[model samples]
Target: GAGVSQSPRYKVAKRGQDVALRCDPISGHVSLFWYQQALGQGPEFLTYFQNEAQLDKSGLPSDRFFAERPEGSVSTLKIQRTQQEDSAVYLCASSTDRGSVADTQYFGPGTRLTVL
Candidate 1:
């Protein structure tokens, strides 16, 4: 019963560079989500995937951001041309079901990205 976990708990990137962060969701979970959290703000959904299908990605801020959950398990979030404005905590969450508000998502500690 491994919970979701993210890599690099912290990252520092120069503007214009690209970075890839990883996430490992709990085994057998069917839903996964990515979110961005800014200082003093609540986590905002970036995208969500049900199994290998990306069910929603309307919250991704720009084309520079991409995500995937190919195996219906682990997922990755990649940001290109990093901007100082992108500095924030990237969080990952997972649940047992999809398309239900009743699903309780468990979140990882998050990767704190700081763009310089």
Candidate 2:
């Protein structure tokens, strides 16, 4: 892929169900980030990874949310015990910079997860 790509572009999950979202970043990008965007609101940072090491996860809303970037290029965001509040678009982005705060990120189309 020339840019970031995400799997399961759209997902519908019943309450209590678990879901995993996949993200494949551009080759050689060293920084990856996960964000959650609610209706009419901007994306909120969820986590960040530099290479295969998770450097920040303080923005994750709860323990039910987890993200990993093993081997550095591919990442996954998992939400366990889904709730209605979890309904939102999960976005994955990558940057060529080494996890710098000012890095310009290229985003994927995102996976829209709807919880019922």
Compared to the true structure, candidate 2 yields what TM-score?
0.95
Clashes of each: 0, 0
Candidate 2: list runs displaced more than 4 Å: 98-101
Report how far residue 101 has shifted in candidate 2, in Å: 5.4
TM values, all candidates: 0.96, 0.95
Total clashes for model 2: 0
Find the candidate with the highest lDDT and give its number: 1
Best by TM-score: 1
Candidate 1 residue spans exceeding 4 A from truth: 98-101
Candidate RMSDs in order: 1.2, 1.4
Per-residue alpha-carbon lDDT of candidate 2 for residues 32-54, written as tens digits (9 for 90 to 100): 99999999999999999989999
How accurate locally, in lDDT, is each candidate? 0.95, 0.94
| Candidate 2 worst ten-residue window by lDDT | 95-104
lDDT of 1 by residue, 1-116 (tens): 67789998999999999999999999888999999999999999999999999989999999999999988989999999999999999999999996567999999999999999
